[model samples]
Target: GTYRAFVDQLPRLDALGVTAIELLPVHQTDPQEGSYWGYMPLCFGAVHAQYAAGDDPAAELAALVAAAHELDIEVWLDVVVNHTTEVDAAGPTYHLRGLDDAMYRRRGDGSYIETTGCGNDVDADHPAAQDLVVWSLDRLADLGVDGFRFDLAAVLSRSPSMMSRLEAWARTRDVRTIAEAWDAAGGYQVGRTWPGTGWMQWNDRFRNDVRSFLRADDGSAALMEQRVQGSPDLFDAPGDSINYLSCHDGFTLYDVFAYDAKHNGANGHGNRDGADDNRSWNCGWEGDDGAPDTVLALRRRQLRNAWCLLAMSHGVPMVAAGDEHGRTQGGNNNAYNQDNATSWIDYARRDEFADLEHFVTGLLALRARHAVLTQPEWWGDALTFLDRRGVDGSTAGPSIGWSVGDLCVLANAWWHPTEFALPPGSWTMAVDTNQADLLDPPTPVDASAYVVGPRSAVILTR
Candidate 1:
């Protein structure tokens, strides 16, 4: 049932320029409250029977994979190997609990060590658990799936040796593995967690810093610089980060700028459900409003700013679904349970949505065109940061206190306009996130300076 639906939807998504469909946990989950994000997994070996067609679950999955492959789209599975749905005695029974309780989960003093905050954490240190995890991955790999987005991956590496072993096992496979490496403490020490070269982590630092800059926080400029260049403070190597402005969790990008405080009353939490430190700004208005042209202009510019930052950042860019159309959850940042219009992508708002889609497509294409932007190698010929002199220099060579190479990015986080003189050469104006008229046409004179609108970003290339 679910697989067939996905198979039918694959072509449409491809047409919309989606090359990957990251499926929420597909493993067997509790049947009653089963479809809630798939984080509450019950069986690691078996596919969720409800998603399968009739009794032939394997066949259904195989067919789905074949269809996606035919469209040249890759299927990425969301795996939750860190924990299981076996919460209490009332929870559903699965392979791990049935086979051997001790082999499946971690226990201390005869009590389950609940590191995942989801009742129980898998005993990754256990040899049996390791075997089960590795076997499950190998099974998916054999089925022609592309990669895995490991949910709560930090919990899987509670024991350092276990993380190392898992990384070693992952490297053997011909697929990509992305880790949700965030722990509860907000410490993004990727250097300590990542096992080796093959893993890429969700860069929370980038998300926070970029959001802070958009809100015009003090010292945000410095933080934004760190994020755009890939936080060397958090990550040890380059290209090991997945830069995202918004994701399935927390406030949508539109909501981030549309609301200063979360309105999560819909989640039955009386607005106390989600995070309070959202780092968002409402741009002088709270929630939704059919305001004047100025308000709409500001909102549009903010959206472009977030998109450009995500695309230009030094990492794998993850664009949350519906972000292109400025989707909002009506200020419900934590709409994990409210799976109504709050979570689904709104196909309405066609005009605004189309513009956003076009902007993102062009942004992605621009990034792809520049090898320095996406290359695994650090500080390649494609990226650069220019100082005032370099920005105003007559020649293209390196100027005082500037990182020069290919593309030059200018960001003006201040409320007032800022101007930068262009290097004396034919430099194409790549993007103006503020949607300002100054960015129109003729690629301003080589020696002439370009004005950046307040709270905006601009990309230039020679």
Candidate 2:
């Protein structure tokens, strides 16, 4: 039934120019536990019967993929190999827990490892666990998914060789693997690790840097330079970093500017379950409603700013569902346990923010038309830090510039207008975030000086 619900959205999703659908885990969950986000897998081989469209869960999932493929959409599964539904002594003996205690790493005193921060983490270092992971992945591909996004992916690298071998096998089957590359425990290997592992990682550095930059924080220009260039410092390989500013974990793109902090009072954990350190900003008022008209408009402008940066950056980009248009979690940052409207994609909001939706589709089209943007190679050259003529250059100001060949993307995160010092050539405005389309795009600047609007970004082509 749930598979039918997902399939029903394909016509809309495909129209929105979405390339892939990365589903949260649909694997079998512990019958006793109340995990709403489906990360607690009890059996890796079985599909969650709850989402079954018919009597058969696997067939239902395959049908879902088959329908997506009909629209040329790739399907990605968020696979959890880190741990199981079984927590500790209080947990029941599911499939893996019942089979062998060796699969679960234990302390000298016999407490199960909690690296995933999910209570009971599996030990992939052991041979049996490694084999199980490989088999689970193979099983998922057989069920018709195009790729796997490994949850807390660095945990699988507890045995680097084992994870590598698994990736090699996946590549052979033409399946893509994206890793979270960091775990709740000590594994924080972002760009330094996972090279040559046949995997891409969710670039949190990219996310945070972009968030800080758009929030008009200090020293964001230097950070944006590294991020827009595909995070070369962390990922040396092409398409190895998933550059995203919003994901399922935190605030929606709309809320990134609409709420200064997470308003998770609805989560019922005393608003204490989610991260306190969300690098976000409220345009003026918390949440969307009742803000001054100018403040509300600024929220939309900031979203466009974020989207413009996301579209132009090198590497695969991911957006949380419902972000194309404004979607707020009513300020709930951590909605893992939210199974209701709080977490569901609101199509109604999609209609309300139609202009933002149009901007996103147009941005993706602009990216597709330009090859340099997709293939952003890092090389040492004369990169310019731009500001208006006659204005003193301030390193901490919310202004940044990146150029490749004749094309330059000038962004002003500053709340006021700033002039960009263009190269000595006539230029065409490839994209102006304030504009609706790029074809008969904004007028070409005939001078070496162009003023970027407050809280907006512009792409100029010579």
On lDDT, the leading prediction is 2
Count of backbone clashes for each model? 0, 1
Best by TM-score: 2
Error of model 2, residue 78, in angstroms = 0.9
Which consecutive 10 residues in model 2 have the weakest lDDT in total?
A: 387-396
- In Å, residue 396's CA in model 1 sits off its true spot by 24
Q: Show where candidate 2 strays beyond 4 Å.
A: 376-396, 435-439
Tens-digit lDDT track of model 2 for 167-249? 68887889888888888877887876664367778899998999998988888878888888788787876478889988888
Model 2 scores a TM of: 0.94
